[model samples]
Target: MPTLSQQLLAKEAKYGASNYKPLDVMLCRGEGVWVWDLDGKRYLDCLSAYSAVNQGHCHPRILAALTEQASRLTLTSRAFHNDQLGLFYEELCTLTRSTRALPMNSGAEAVETALKVARKWAYQVKGVPADQAEIIVCDGNFHGRTLSVVSFSTDEPSRHGFGPFTSGFRIIPYGDADALEAAITRNTAAFLVEPIQGEAGVIIPPAGYLARARALCTEHDVLLILDEIQTGLGRTGALLAEEHEGIEADLTLIGKALSGGFYPVSAVLSHDAAMGVLKPGEHGSTFGGNPLACAVSRMALKVLVEEGMIENSARMGRRLQDGLAAIQTGVVREVRGRGLMIAIELDPAAGGARRFCEHLRDQGILCKETHTNTLRVTPPLVIDTDTVDWALDRFSRVLSAA
Candidate 1:
């Protein structure tokens, strides 16, 4: 008979879509920064479910909020009001320093919401002609996989066989302020970008790139939309990665950790000029602001701030980066990131990132590789110094052996 892991993998292969190439580890339970395999093997969680579990997995507070709210109310949709939605809005808006917010179920939905709102704002407020509005996007952006969101993608794997794509999107090289300035025209509606491109090997933009982009967007009257779904909610040692640049976007998208990995929750935060265009019946979601999600998200935010996870992320991130940098290995080409969202790029001559990732997995450390040769090493924000040291030791051993 097959082992539990093998049986599960076989079952998935037989029934599930062949969309993901997940590591062969079968994770059955997680808490804080550690996960257990089916046979009771332990591993440090380095990916944090792509930063969705920034507060760590199965947090007691978030779980309590989920259970409590679920017992009372779950879904009211947007057709009727729920008691928690208003408090969610108030708390979210106040925390993010935004005037308005629209809740959604996924990061992709938040991105879609932002796109629709930006186009509407362009037509109504910026005087752009209808159906002629163009939104500027950066290359290597991984906003989401939805059809409309994927329409502007420069990643070929995401775009191939998914067209004929939507129109009115312009692409520019990321971290190029001058390119952004040149791309703007009378019909440009918004400049959509990631503060630090998470999916593109954890690429950090040039210093002051966002500040310059913000200025250019302001001068050109184009809305600045920061896709913070991956980089927000204390993943980058701050409430939002935009804080590092000392700029605020006209529109901001956040998800992933919004519900502390207890639920699927995301939101589009907007200033008055952009979100004001949405009147009733224009847009909404069925499970967007459901009572359970709201209560869970509220507690998630509360715990993130009150528990000092952000500060711990900053301190541990520095330690992790320093430790990785000190590792003398021919395989590692570079180490770069902000807060817990770090990456180690391997030299192409040293095989690829997958081999190193597999080796680390064997040593009880869980991390995933992005692109071709870059290993993304984002542990949970709630990770401590000792765990960071343990993971770093494993990483050093793996790279040295490789």
Candidate 2:
């Protein structure tokens, strides 16, 4: 006879696509920063569904909003206006400080939306030749997994077997302003980048890299699109990671945490010029701005501000980083991150990160390994100092053993 966890894993393997290599534990419920396994074991959720639960899992306010809106009305699509869509737009724009907002169901859809808008803006506003406009992208970006999104990916694993892909995208090394400058041309319509590369081992860009990139975009009349799907809504201490660099993107992509992990909500926030090219019937989604998503996102944003989660992230992040740095472990090669999106890079000679992650998991701290050698530790923004310290103690023990 198999244990419940074993049975579930086997069932998933037999029935589902083999796209993910998840841990052995099977989570049944989550609240705030902790999740319970089927066996009723409690573990600190360090990954937060790749920062989607920054407001913490099953946030009461967001859950209430979801339930309330769902009971009243759910999907109206884009054909007819829903009462919640306009308020959603207003609140999202005001929060992100953008002039226009295009709602979508996932981060990939928002990325696709931005690409289309940028290309159209290039042809119509920048006088670029039709079908010739190019968009610059960073090398280690993980925007999304769509065919078009994967078209520009530099990761061989992501790009393999996905082509022949869409054209009009150029790649450059991340955090290199000079490389970016060299890559640009009159046909360049936008520079699509992650403010901090999240999936590529939580890589932080060089200081002033964003400022320089912003300046270059302005000089060349190219739109700057910041993909903040993983780093936005207070995951990186600030409301948006772009605020750290004191720069604003011409277009910003947000999702994951937008509905506080209660729903799949994403949006492309644009300045007046970038989004102005899209007329009605040009681009839309069936459930992009559905009433339920709008209502849930509204509550998510409100609670994030009212609960002081952003400030908590900053303070807790500093504590986490300091603790990681002070760990007396020779296996640790480096510790880096912004806010709660931290990473521990192990020495190549010390073996891969998976074993360390497994050890931590056994000790009840649930984080994930990235890029084989780095452990990404992104807790919920609502996590407290004591929980962080508890997690750190487990991390210290695991790293020491490794």
- TM per candidate comes to 0.99, 0.99
Q: Against the hidden true structure, what lDDT does model 2 obtain?
A: 0.94
Q: Show pairs that collide, candidate 1.
A: none
Residue-level lDDT tens digits of model 1 in 1-402: 998789889999999999999988999999999999999999999899999999998999999999999899999888998899999999999999999999999999999999999999999999998899999999899999999878988888998998888899999999999999999999999999999999999999999999999999999999999999999999999999999989999999999999999899999999887899999989998899999999999999999999999998899999999999999988888999999999999999988888887899999999898888999999999998888888888888899887
lDDT of 2 by residue, 339-396 (tens): 9999999999988998887898899999899889999999999999899899889998
Evaluated at residue 259, the lDDT of candidate 2 is 90
Per-model RMSD to reference: 0.7, 0.8
In model 1, the worst 10-residue window by lDDT is 350-359
Candidate 1's TM-score reads 0.99
Instruction: Give the runs in model 1 whose Cα sits over 4 Å from its true position.
Output: none
- The window of 10 residues in a row where model 2 has the poorest summed lDDT is 349-358
Give stretches of model 2 more than 4 Å off. none
